[model samples]
Every structure is written in structure tokens, then in C-alpha cells.
Target: MADMQKALRARILGAGIVPRVIWGRKVPQGTALPYLQLFAVSDPRPGHLKGYNGGRTTRVQADCKAESYAEAKAMSDALVPLLAAPATVDGIKFGHTKAEGPQDLGEDTAAGFVHRMSLDLLVWHSSV
Candidate 1:
């Protein structure tokens, strides 16, 4: 099975909207403005019959951070379409992505303004 989280990070980075894309619980120290941070919320395998292959649905939160709300919104706006487009990342075929935000996360004392988006992606890949 592919590491879906890494695949997601690659996809976003390849989009070229931001210079920095981090995939982990904590953002990198001294990171510049206009970067993306992705964290996996959950990955649950659905029920399947015998001898059947089942894929996992992953829920992820993508945070676009910048010095201001406008910049964060712009980054997020560009991100949505990129994620929505159909493509395969690191051999992981993406079935689809459902987005739930561009929600204003307000000011971050350390990182400045933050805008968040949630994505529920249907990932289909062979089981290991």
C-alpha cells in the first residue's frame, strides 16, 4: 500500500501554489509565509466481502498560512481546484476529494493568519 499522506503532500507541492509543504503534526520552525501544512485526521477501511479488495478513506486537514488573511485565502483558492482534479500521486490513484472549508482560522500569534480546509479523499490502492 502507498503512504497516502505522503502522496497527498506530493500532489499539493507539485501544484506549485506554495513553496513549503509540510506533512506532520507540527509545522517547521522559521517557515516562510505562504506555506501549506497537512495532517491526517483519520484513515478507516470500509467493510468488504471475502476475497475483495477494500480501499481506505482518508480525512485530512490542510492549513494555508500567511502573513494576512487575503494571502491565505488566495493560496487556499488555488489549492481547491488542484486537489479536485483527477490524477494519480506516487502510484496512488485518487478516486475523488470532497472539501469542507476555506474557513477563516483567524490570527495566529506565532504564524500570523491561517485559513483551513478539510478534505475527505477516497483513495484506492492495492493492499500490502
Candidate 2:
């Protein structure tokens, strides 16, 4: 099966909506504001019954981080509809994404107290 997490990361970055979308939680030093951190909360094969992807459900946490709360929230606001739209990538046919956030995670003081808006996504997809 195609790697859904990688595909989602590529798609988001390719959208050019944000300056950067890192594949993991940890951001590198000296990165700019209004960036994204992508994390896979879970990736489970829901069933063996056949289709494009075998009915996989990918739970992901996509956090928008910035120097201020508004910037973080704005970045995430721009992403919600895009992620929720239906599409296909790298043999992974995506269905609508169910999101549970833009939840304020306050700030990460360790990371310069960057304000974070977190988007938890439940994605339905299949790898054809």
C-alpha cells in the first residue's frame, strides 16, 4: 500500500498554502513562522474487504505553529477546507476528512512559546 502519511504531507506542502509542513512533530531550529507539523495519530486497516485502500482510516494531528495565536489559527483555518475536500494521491484515494480541531494548544515554551492550533483529522482512504 502507498504510504498515506507521506502522501498527505506532500499534498499539503504542494498546496503552497503554508511556507512549510514538516513530516514530524519536532520542528528544526531557525524555522520561520506559520509552519505546519504533521503527526500520524494512528493508521489502521479497518477491513480486509476490498477497495482502493482496503478501507483504511488514518488519524492524524496537523499542528499549525506560529509566533502568535492569530497567525496559528489563520493558518489552520485555511487548511481545514482543503483537507476536508475529497481527492486522490499516489494511489491513495481520499475521502472526506473529519476534523476535530483548530484546538488551541496554548504555547510551546521550549519552542520559543510558539502558539499552536491543532487539527486532529480522521481520514478515510484506500490505496488502489
lDDT (Cα, tens digit) per residue for candidate 1, span 1-128:
33777777788788788888888777767777778887777766666666445566577778887777677788878877777776777767676576777677766565444544433334343333
- Best candidate (score: lDDT): 2
lDDT of 2 by residue, 7-102 (tens): 787778778878888877577877888889988888876544563436677788888888888888888888888888989887777889988877
Stretches off by above 4 angstroms in model 2 are: 48-53, 108-111
lDDT of 2 at 81: 86
TM-score of 2: 0.84
Angstrom error at residue 27, model 2: 2.2
Once fitted onto the true fold, the runs of candidate 1 whose alpha carbons sit more than 4 angstroms away are 111-128
Task: In model 2, state the lDDT of residue 52.
Answer: 44
User: lDDT of each model, Cα atoms only?
Assistant: 0.68, 0.81
| Clash count, candidate 1 | 0
TM-score for each prediction? 0.80, 0.84
